[model samples]
Target: MSTKTVAGNYFEDFTIGQEIVHATPRTVTEGDIALYTALYGSRFAATSAATFAESMGLERMPVDSLLAFHLVFGKTVPDISLNAVANLGYAGGVFGVPLYPGDTVTTTSTVIGLKENSNGRSGVVYVRSVGTNQKGEMVLDYIRWVMVNKGNLDAPAPEIVIPDLPGAVAAEDLKVPYDLAGRDYDTVLAGSPYLWDDYEVGERIDHVDGMTIEEAEHMLATRLYQNTAKVHFNQHAQAQAKIGRRLIYGGHIISLARALTFNGLANGQSIAAINAGAHANPTFAGDTVYAWSEVLERIELPGRTDIGALRLRTVATKDLPCADFPYRGEDGKYLPQVVLDLDYTVLIPRR
Candidate 1:
């Protein structure tokens, strides 16, 4: 037998402090921006119009933050999560600089924690990954943990190590582009008149729109990111599993929810940071995704009167409308219809 074929890494394969430089550096382009917009219908003015972005002091429209996130995340899949059963959660994610079309992105990850499941059939691997541009400027940094399947059920468990992670990124550390400060923003062109001052803490906005997920669209988006997780593909193999269907990548749901928020939050132009996120439930093709957002906190940036930040909790529900803000049960368990619960910071114009 040829020894060239390689099986992907499992729980037993990772060690504390191992560094992995991911493959396939990707250069963002106009084509990716167009395709992503078509896939999710994202309409933030800063990402959609060059003229609008220039009005806000950017030379050109930058790619959507989520698109940059997906591209960087895709590079880590082949090396980190090829055999993952599930991606658990993310924390302390920060975007350093806006990624322009011509910028090339590469990624590296460090294994920071590990824990064997009581069943001994699986384990969780925690890694902190950083994506940097060609100039070696860090574009994004975050910590994520995944549940990976074990190739050998009888393999001895690794030492349990769980790194201490912050529950959220502090407001003072949120990064805003240098050019974006002190610029007069246009709400009329931005689509929504609601500004940072308009949103009050504890206010909820039902996006009042839904998008049906198509198998082809999800698969294309996944491939565009170059994410090769088997559960997201290989329907025949998935049919034999518990869910019995290919899983939609959680990032897909996040982008969809973020896009849907445009109806009520169009003026919230840039994603300053991702505090935390979770895929509470799995979503499959044909499910109509709905979203709603609650304002968690309002922040004022020192010396900048043109912009402010809103800590928003955006939730995605599959086949469930957000009119009632569907979420966890009284027992603190996610309802079956809830697919995503994302907490992130958005920088919006100050009226």
Candidate 2:
């Protein structure tokens, strides 16, 4: 009897070029940092110690990049992915200024691409979102696409418009903070002696650690980000579907893989950009996650000898060790044990 109740946007409800400003600006806090460290076991020195960060020319310890990413991504869930089937992939992601505690973040998204599925029950929606701090400075930006269910099967298909996106952020375009230069870093406090020049291209490092996922840990991590996706929380609903259990958020696996890398890559101080990423398979509670990394490329910043960038491919697997590099089958299909395949860049001190 009332048309007031609001359901989230469905596939058929979207129009290309529409702009949606998400609600609820969130303020970063020390509590968020503590909870994130507890959940992911991240040990990046720049984000873990204010004194160490200040020694490297930062004003204070910055929030973990993935933490900032999850927060901004959470803001778009209700307006963009609430009725989604799955988050498909990501591309052309770039981080701007470092986020510190007490800074507030807000987001806006624009629909950039759309394609109807042949099955007629679902379609893909692509959106580019920009997250900005209270000072109106952009903190992060990225393009993500999701598969969303249709609210009306009979609705006529909208004109398809797929945006042409970059495969990677250009090396020259990466912004290294001005204060993060000068090579005055402390190796002892940073937790590793490896520097930019120490890593050779084509080298692979198995992180040699595994952490079994617990139901409560993932639930708490997802809730802390304010992510309200039902597939991550509703077990009864998921029990009726394929997989038969709640799916662990892919970002959770990303953070776990990043944390495990501290064993070998602790000196790789900060994330520069995310070139591409894919959640190859779903993860569930009780799966033991392991990680491995391959150095793809190395770039020297034009004017700065203080730091350089390493292009890395970090792979996460469940119940499988990465000693032999378990990636895909001969036919190019991901193995059942493989859960994440991420390609990104990180900045490390130069010797």
Candidate 3:
């Protein structure tokens, strides 16, 4: 069976500068859009309706940013993190062209950094992956580090290298895929009255809703993205681990939290970039998730008056509400209830 089956990569097998072209390009479909909306109940107009997208000067409505992100990220999992302990963090994520249905996305990645854990049982691998459409247009570009188990405990550790990542995606570097072009934007239909100019730096918003994860629902979400992460699927394997159940995919929490943002940030229509993110804690089935966001900075484009950007910090927690905005503790670690800490940028109309 040595050449008949694939067991996936382990920590010791990775090296810096290695380029990996991931398998399987996925075509986005209206069916994918429908299932995603049913799972998260996302209501962003520009992505929700083709008519609303035309009003925003786009030829066709785009899929949700997080959906595009998940599809791309899923493509990298088998080669990058199949025998993984956890996916640690993400940084410098930039979304380029709008991903409309029928666009096929393919992903390729490069090993940028590697560090063996002190225990010799695991190590961290940093990879930069780029997802491009069949037209060769970039869809999503980002960096992520994952902690992976070592299949051979006796294998020697390689030279430790950690890539220097950006603190945030600079405003000048943001990609504005489309302009409003003086078209009419209906606030009432969009579900929010607030615009770019109405929000202030450091303003916090509680999304004011909670959703409990179901065992079947999390599995469906994982499969919908075609994310073949064993930890998310194999309850038998996970039952032996400390968590003792099927682990919920981290992207599930990101999508759920992003969906909750609609209640307060409905007008923050398009995601431009993901500066950074961390899954502070693991989430399992039956845990109720809630979310909130803080405006970190406001960005004005150099020559555009139709729209602007907001650097946002959106936090998601399990079994805790964000009324007081739960986050880092006195020790600088995230609160136990916190599941996701995401720093991203979104575009909103300028009123």
Candidate 4:
């Protein structure tokens, strides 16, 4: 719980096989679901109306895949990117399993490669992080790269090794929740703006509003991820486990954080690139989710910047007006209300 600042630096600081353990585990809840549905306008039947999900063969719609990825990644920030200069890219990502409403999420990383910038001021570090549930089953995995500052040229160079990763997941790897098969579309109630084609790069959007999550809300999300590690669902679990009440789902925080980023970042609709990101601490229910963003880097691909890449940060909390907010409690640990800290790259339209 020390409040010391972290010193991060250039590629020279990273070894090909070092592992980073992020601090704090999170629980998921129902509030996370309601906010996700309200903010993103995603109408996957399983996620929204519960009745629809039951028909699809699920106990309930599981958290979205991107949401799950964000939660796991968010936990790695303070330990990994406090000094990051830029996010580079993503690869070899996979969704390992379904997440439920009351589960705890934890993450770990293995360094893959380190490439020093010819200029020596900065370099890129590639890493693969995996997210796991309470039972220790893999929930999500992905590869990412980041630009880091080189504080000193004298820093020793470490061995560089890259990992082999798959592009998209095979259908079999996808764990469709119980009872979820065919979807029930709610065209009238669902507010979809762009359908793959409607997006153009450089366009920014505001997600509009925020919502507060309750303890129960987060518990539900953790359970949905099938992250049954007790700390997320039972108070008794915390007494014996040393964790507090059922933790909030890292994915719930991710979704809420991403939704909060709608303002100023709405134009970057597609997630063309995932340079790198992390969840700084555990977020619980009763935290209000809020967000804002910046356009960090862009690229022109073939005939288009039509879809551009944007580096962004999305933070969540237990109350309103989280813009320019502060994290950390007097004890030096995360505040009870603060939920998340995230950074990533998204695709935007440039038409």
Task: Return the top candidate by TM-score.
Answer: 3
When 3 and 4 are scored with TM-score, the better candidate is: 3
User: For candidate 4, which ten residues in a row score worst on lDDT?
Assistant: 172-181
Among residues 3 or more apart in sequence or in different chains, the pairs in candidate 1 whose N, CA or C atoms overlap within 3 Å are none
Candidate 4, 232-338: lDDT as tens digits: 45577466645555555555666666655544343343343343444555555666666544444344434332233444444556565655555666787656555
- lDDT of model 3 at residue 349? 94
How many clashes in each structure? 0, 0, 0, 69
Candidate 2 clashing pairs, residues 3+ apart or interchain? none
**Runs in model 1 with CA error above 4 Å?**
178-182, 240-243
lDDT scores for all predictions? 0.91, 0.89, 0.93, 0.56
Against the true structure, candidate 1 reaches a TM-score of: 0.97
Ranking by lDDT: 3, 1, 2, 4
lDDT per residue (tens digit) for residues 64-143 in model 1: 99999999999999888888888988999998889999999999999999999999999999999999999999889999
State model 3's lDDT.
0.93
| TM-score of each candidate structure, all chains considered together | 0.97, 0.96, 0.98, 0.51
- For model 1, state the Cα shift of residue 208 in Å: 0.6
What does candidate 1 score in Cα RMSD to the true structure? 1.3
Candidates' RMSD to native: 1.3, 1.5, 1.0, 12.3
Q: Relative to the unseen true structure, what is the C-alpha lDDT of residue 75 in candidate 1, on a scale of 0 to 100? A: 96
Q: How far is candidate 2 from the true structure (C-alpha RMSD, Å)?
A: 1.5
Candidate 2: worst-modelled 10 consecutive residues by lDDT:
175-184
Provide the lDDT at 243 for model 3.
58
Model 2 residue 333 CA deviation (Å) reads 1.3
